[model samples]
Target: MSDVILLAPHDDVAVATRDLVPGESVTTGDGESDGNPTVVVVRDRVPRGHKVALRDLPLGSEVRKYGQVIGRTTRPVPAGSQVHVHNLEMPRMPDVPGASDAASDYAYATEHRELPVPEGERPTFLGYRRADGRVGTRNYVAIVTSVNCSASTARFVADQFRGRALAQFPHVDGVVALTHGSGCGLVPTSEGGRTLLRTLRGYAAHPNVGGVLVLGLGCEMLQVDALVAEAGIPADTLVRRLVIQETGGIRATVRAAVAEIEAMLPELDARRREVCDVSDLVLGLNCGGSDGYSGITANPALGVASDLLVAYGARSVLAETPEVYGAEHLLTRRAVSPEVGRRLIDRIAWWREYAAAGGGTLDNNPSPGNKAGGLTTILEKSLGAVAKAGSADLAAVYQYAEPIDTPGLGFMDTPGYDPVSVTGLVAGGATVVVFTTGRGSVLGCKPSPSIKVATNTAMYLRMHEDMDLNAGRIVDGTASLAEVGREIFDLVLAVASGRETVSEELDLGQDEFQPWLLGTVT
Candidate 1:
């Protein structure tokens, strides 16, 4: 097997497949080797998953990976030297002519290709069909808290349904308490308040939730009645509300909530999973704890599966706005229209200002864990992160927690934080999520199942029980990318058909229900 993987022919760097010592030699080709190869001797001791310069680079020279500009050389570096933060830095956004604005490179829909529908019979999954015409991958009772004051009460109510509490109701997926840190201090009309309300309403109306108990502290700014009114849940859907202050206290509210949930259990359990078309599925795409191999292995494989789902007329949502900073141009070119492309660029612009307000730049990403795993800058990471979206045309772009109304592939503006990102996706109506991680991220989302795909074999094996699938096999050379992608696509149907993910078996998603907090707390 080759010691390095070169993604594109004109790339300036190759990812070290294994640790390399000085004087070690590796060969590069256009990913698929044409008979001829160029050999470069390793000048630095490059660790596995890190980058090796394919040729001599002078100061300010742009470094390319995935055939895109990742960053630029900070100093003159010899070929075969390790290329990383010490020798490379993010390019000034202004210097990169077409990065943020309309330039010749920002052509809209230039790379957009309409997805051709599959010829065979469309695939199906066993799902709970809701009265509202939505299909649910899981049928659960949700205890949604309107304010932080009611969070504990909501959790307590959900806790009552743990263990064998719902054993008799075989179809029920158990109760989940959707709690968060902010709800009351901010003005309801503020961006943060509106975002919190949208997130809460989205979950209450989420197809995965068969019944909901909206809990709140009566004195709080986000009132229970207001949330219920705004949720627009079907009249027949079992939705109840409880106010802690009116109910006397947490104990009383929990008791009332538990009883309400108990009353809704039979109805929820009676909702059987009927055979539903794969088109009814909304798959959320996310990545966390990423490493260098992320872009090469799991991400691309997931992208292929995303493309397959889009071809089937299903919606696949790619989120984590900040993570996609540098690669926005790729998505813009694939936009279905100039307006959709502009919407994406506008979000990117918002992120730049948001970051600046906090005294940081969009390049503040590529977290410590990412750097340790060989990712050097946000540019490199964003290029890799965008792979999860596949090559589908950008159908629509949405604000954080907005309802996902479009069919094909869509983008949701959200923070790069794992739990928060997935929360927005789930709230936006994703029935299932596929999360790719190179450095073992054990994140899960209830109401919606999260399928964790590892980018490298060693981490997958080390954290075998936590991960649902091993895309690492692609990097290991044991399985082709298409095979693993098919495996993921198949697993999505299976999981949607009631198959349990590793996170579900471990009961790991209840606490991961974090709504993105925007604007100010007060």
Candidate 2:
């Protein structure tokens, strides 16, 4: 094979698929060794899976990939030099949400979700119907304690609702023990502390929630009444708050909380689900423990599936901003407008500063698991990560924990932490999720269902119980990416309509409801 490889024909740079030895005679395109075309070795070592400027590009010129500019070059670069952090810069764009002129980007899709599925369509699942008319694949009630001092009581109360003992409340999903370390040790007026309280309140009032009984130590930074007032949920929502100090300490609090929850069991058990459209579904596209085949098999499959959901008017979300460093140009071109594209570029730039302020580089990603999976750099990993967005036109992008109401393919700003990222998506209104993994992340989001797709067969078999579908078959040469994509699309509809994912099956969303903490408190 030739030493140089162009990713996209109209792009400005080519990435080295393998190491280029010193003075090795190689052609830029096809393997024809011409007498003279153009040649330059700008470095003693050009690592595999790194980018090499395809031509001698001058400083301040745009570095194009996926036929769009990813960033700008800071200094003149040689034809074969590696383009990276030292010389490349992610541009700054403002954070204002700009309006985009509506246009059709789905002309290629002849089939819409409104079209009838052919005969033998088996898209069905048993789901729960909330009071607000939203359907849930899993039914869960959370014993949310607003204070760390009452955490033990919350856990003790949740224990009563576990396993087969929960059969009496058949309509109620699983019960969760939601507690945290922050209701103390900080100023009650602090934004950081207040944001945490709002996050906890949001969880208490989430639509998937059947009922919530808040426990408090009565003197924490986040008081139960404050959480209740901030959440603004109606008393008829089967939610209640109890204070340990007011209830005469821990034992009294647990007894009083259990009595309060048990009182609503009969009412909550009366709720039922009806047929709902796939459009009611908001799906989060995520990847973790990724490998080489993640981009090839699972990620692309998820992307294709995401497009299918968008066709049906379903909301599909892509997150992990840091993971998508190098391959952002593709998304920028697909942005709903130049303004939306600029906002995304700006976020990328801000993250670069954020990383540097803490003494790190934006390229310091691609964890050991990613490396073991044959991904050599952030660029390589991001190229694969972008596939989860599929072929849909980029619709909207939101910051971490911000409300996401717009449908179609959307991007949410979030860190690369699997649990935290998924939490933001669920909070932003994704009722179901499709998570792709090559390295086997045992991630599960209950209440809002999660479907895990494995990149390769080995990891799938090793973590079968945690994983729901096997996209690895595509990499094994037994199935095509489209086939798996179709399967995932069907599964999304099933889960949306009422089927349970493995994580939901295991009552696994108990500890995953965490909010993204942004900026330090003064």
What is the alpha-carbon lDDT for the whole of candidate 1?
0.90
Best by TM-score: 1
Candidate 1 per-residue lDDT over residues 390-505, each given as its tens digit: 89999999999999989999999999999999999999999999999999999989989999999998898899999989887776789999999889999999999999999999
Write candidate 2's Cα lDDT for 146-209 as tens digits. 7678878888998887889768777777778877666777666665675566567666766677
Which 10 residues in a row give candidate 2 its minimum summed lDDT?
98-107
In model 1, which residue pairs have backbone atoms overlapping below 3 Å? none
Per-prediction TM-score: 0.97, 0.76
Error of 1 at 55 (Å): 1.0
- Count clashes in each candidate, considering only residues at least 3 apart in sequence or on different chains: 0, 3
